[model samples]
Target chain A: MIRSITQKKTEEELDQLLTGIARIFIIGCGTCVTMTHTGGTPEVTEIKEKLLKKGKLVTGDLVLPVACDNLTAEVLHENRSKIDLADGLLILTCAFGVQTIARQVKKTTIPGLDTLFIGKETGLGQFDEICTQCGSCILGETGGVCPVTSCHKGLVNGPCGGTKNGKCEIDEKKDCAWTLIYNRLKDLNRLDLMKRYQKPKNFQREPRPGKYWLTPT
Target chain B: MVSLFKKALESKKFVVTSEVAPPKGTNLEKIKHHIELLKNKVDGINITDHQSSVMRYPSLGGALLVKEMGGEPILQMTCRDRNRLALQADLLFAYSRGISNVLCLTGDSILMGDHKEAKGVFDMDSSQLVATIRKLEKGKDLGGNDLDGAVSFCAGAIVTPEANPLEPQLIKFEKKVEAGAEFIQTQAIYDLDLFKHFMEYAEQFPVKVLAGVILLTSAQMARFMNKNVAGVNVPQNLIDELSTAPKGRAIEKGIEIAGRMIKKIRKQKLCTGVHIMAIGREELVPEIMSAAELG
Candidate 1:
């Protein structure tokens, strides 16, 4: 899943960097990050109002449909004159959106938010990490349960001695990921699948800054 | 080594067991006294593993103490604290130490425990833990690595007959039995008639069933357990009785109630045994047994 995350930066921190700059443009995201109310149109509007109250001129704002999309670059080029009037760009979206905007704009782009993690909403107003972008998938052997991301210790052949009553010994609030995988496999009556000792995860950290491709169509 | 508990399960007579909650500190005097007092009276002594999600001295440590004091220990193992590797390793350790009986549990949610910030490592639930014991007995661990020596255990798991939505619990009960659980202990059960209903469905399985009897020391304790403890429904009548008990005689009343239930369970041969959870009230378990006329 193309998941985004929550913002952690505060308004005051954003204001500190914008010190003497008069006019400021705000940009938000309409997709994934927006799902958490971080970079939505309303949030961008709220920030604009705050900037106006701070005595800084609010040039304009836009909640792009997927702030990381290349189309956002085109939107920035179209509003170049409005952006040029401002000393910097205030980003309410994630790091990807901030960087994307920065690449296209002459003005310094300052991020107003810090991204949290790649997770999905597991319950009403609750988001849980379902994947760690491990670059490889092992859900089939684990009875459709993802152990790498769910487990705190992330043991492939798991259940260290500290586990008590299916709770993680490290962090008691979280469910033991390996325990979950075991139960799921048991219910499916495919417990034999757990017999195969999975080798330590090859995190595929090679070629440091990772990239993915399909053959250029 | 096969435990006396295993022998009791195979016997025709009613069996008895009681639990001991290890102290939060390093003091083992209370545990030693309880073991000395009730060791021979009951079939086995259960040492709780961080029961109710609260961290106490390790149950395994207490189990070793029980063995040292010449008492049979059913090491209570929960899936909350450790992952599979640790679980299997501990089982090996327990087996090596001659602590052979195990009560496998999925454990209470960490949200209910002393450590709220702690993460629950439910790498496996109770059902899975039972299966793991069976696998260990077969000469290999969950990862299929052959061991230097295989282990054997009289494995057990928990059931909550009085759970409000019992169908899910029933499903888990069946799964636990299927996972090679030889005996099943329940959470605190008050209403005998309600327990009878649970037994009606439970009788079809081959596993032994032990009705859990948590001593109701006072009305407040009963109400508190009713509100906080899952699957433990203290009927209004028991609460009413505790409420009317003469001041400072609540323990006597609690013993009388526990005795009455055990007496009835034995008289009717309802199940294989009664697992008494005299939490923090270990000194009074013998009185409960005497009141039941078990001795």
Candidate 2:
């Protein structure tokens, strides 16, 4: 399953973000954030305790099963009185969940975690970014390995001169994406694809602020 | 008209080029001195563009300075700070100013630089940047719009000759050639045997290859590059020789070693030319040239 990988904001940044808010209702997610240990029930309870000790009023807290789902509105309505007593909603979830909750509530929503990337759980607890949704997909030629998201510079033609022993220059532990694609293509007898010249990417296909509709009125 | 650098490459002579890095601030005194010193000695002088992603004086500005000082300037452009529109606009500006030589590079990662938080705008890779240069020469913009004045450049790209798993780097080298790279200035090479092997394969390409020779200041620096810098493998013997240099004279010994390698590369006709990168030690380029018997 695609997961929203995230990391908690620094204590200094969080303090600055919540400087004006005194009374707050904490909300966490039980889905992606829960699995990532970033924003779950225990995290919400811990923040509630920390905020209480910092001389702020923690009106209430709740860990919605799926904070980004349409059912989030009804779950928040169940605890309206507790939520209404707060000046802001401290959302300990991914950007999707935080935005979902913000639209359903009138309270000022503050994100506690930074959404790093939409990734896949590659190992027990390891997540790797799989795709960047670069509308003109080249996976068909790259043997199913997406270089746009994997290569540090997102070079299309081939690997930069920074690859050494199948590792990227940025970090020795990280696998060089081109080497991976090269090996995959070599195994499938498609090494000719490695020699093909990829032209300059057309950024118009997936313009920034990407939007799409399945059925237009 | 072909650039002087291109003419030198075509002349089949043992061409020599050295680089000058722009200072961090507006004080261009140091670079000016380096340019004046190398103007008559080397075939061309290359100006670096925020090398290592550390923000510094612009390479375009430095290249103009080289031009003003009556030297052939090879402008280095990286796909690290500018988007396609900005890159194309800069190329136009560069061409209009008569800076007709360019070296396209896939710059170092922004995370490796001083400004760790700055966004890296790698809108095009080096090969794509080379292709864009070709497109601009044909009187069209990246958007396929007609241009009143088309720009022509003796555009070049870089390759890591000793890059591990050499096939991948070779592939990119070929793509750069296909994209209209007329010459290539390779990554700093310390091992000649490995470079000969790379040249054996690179000879098939139509592009001119200039072997990169970076001056080693000390044994420690060589070891650091071996351990930290990617695709740079300084043989153990070179390190031992640097270590053997009497205290404080390691730089002199380093100069000897660099001169020796350049001499061998020239004697063997390993490639078409040599690009000496005296990183921060531009004054010693003349001495390196002298040591190589090219002076």
Candidate 3:
């Protein structure tokens, strides 16, 4: 399943962010973060205890089915009284959920976790980023391997000098994308495609802050 | 109107080249001294561009300095920090200033350097960068716009001859050659038999190959490279030799080792020439060359 991988922010950063606000209401997601054990029920309860231990009032807390879902607005309304009792909302979810809560709630919203990447759960508690959504996909030529996301340098030509024994230079555990592509193409007897010169990627295809609207037929 | 470095490559008389890394700060004293010392000693001096992804004085500025000091500058342009437009613009500027040689590299990963947080802009890999230079020489840019003035250069790229799973690296090498890389500089090689095998394959390509020789300062550094560096396998015997160096004379011993390798490479006509990399010990290049009997 596609999961939004996230890591909890450091306590020091959270402490600095929550200063000057006493009462706190925590929110957690029951979807992706729940599977990752990052912002599930236990994490929300744990944060509440941590906040209470720091002499802060825990007004209330709950784990919504999907913090990023539109139902977040309705759920916040259902618990409006308890949420209003706090100075701010400590959201223990991905940035998408935190932003959704911030947009719906008038109280100050602080993100308790940082979103790392949108990755697929490859194994038990393991995630691997597969695509960058660069908009101009060349998977057809690269034998289904996305170099944009797989290669550390996002090189389209082939492996850089840093590839050693099919591992990336950044980390020995990470597989080199070009090596994977070479092996795949070599298997398919399409090694000639690897030799083709790939021009500079067209950044204009998907400019930053991308947006699109479907035209009604 | 061939560049001097290009002429040397064509001259086929064991062309010797080295590199000078730009400083991290504004001080040019060290770089200037190195350039002045090496201008007449080597055919061309490559000015490294934020080598190993550590931000430093730009290679363009250092190449200009080499030109100012009457030295042949081979600008080392990497795809780690610049987009296609910036790279083409820098190439134009370098050509306008009489800098003629360029060594195209798909630079080291940014994580390897001090600025671990910086964004790495690999807009074009080293092979594409070589192709871009060839395209620019035809009075056009990558954007397909005509230039008022065309640029010419002795373009080159690097290869890791000892890279594990060497086929992928060889594929990239062939692509670079097909993209018009006139010269090829290899990563530091210690195993001559392995390098000879690489050369046997490289001999099929129509490009001048320069064997890369990095000076080993100490045994610990050698071991560190063998452990930490990718594709740089320092044979255990060489490491033992460095470890056995008498006290503080390891640097001289290292020079002896590097010089001996170069002497052997040259005597055997291993490749077209040797591209010596003294790393931080740029001052010792001439000594190394002397030891190799090239001086």
Clashing pairs in 3: none
Candidate 3 C-alpha lDDT tens digits along B82-191: 99989999999999999999999999999989899989999899999999999999999998999999999999999999998888888899999999999999999999
TM-score of chain A of each: 0.86, 0.97, 0.96
Interface RMSD of 2: 0.9
**Model 2 spans with C-alpha error above 4 angstroms:** none
**Docking quality (DockQ) for each candidate:** 0.11, 0.84, 0.84
Best of the two (1, 3) by DockQ: 3
User: What is model 3's DockQ versus the real complex?
Assistant: 0.84
Q: Estimate the TM-score of every prediction.
A: 0.73, 0.98, 0.96
lDDT of 1 by residue, A69-138 (tens): 8999888888877777888888888888888888888787888888777788877767788887777788
RMSD of 1: 7.4
Q: Give each model's whole-structure lDDT.
A: 0.82, 0.92, 0.93
- List candidate 3 stretches off by more than 4 Å: none
**What local lDDT score does residue B279 receive in model 2, on the 0 to 100 scale?**
91
**Candidate achieving higher lDDT, 1 or 3:** 3
For model 2, residues B1-295, the per-residue Cα lDDT tens digits are 5588889989969999999999999998899999989999998899999999999999999999998898999999999999999999999999999898999998989988999999988899999999999999999998899999999999999999888888888888998999999999999999898898899898998989999998999999999999888888889999999999999999999899999999999999999999999998999999999899996
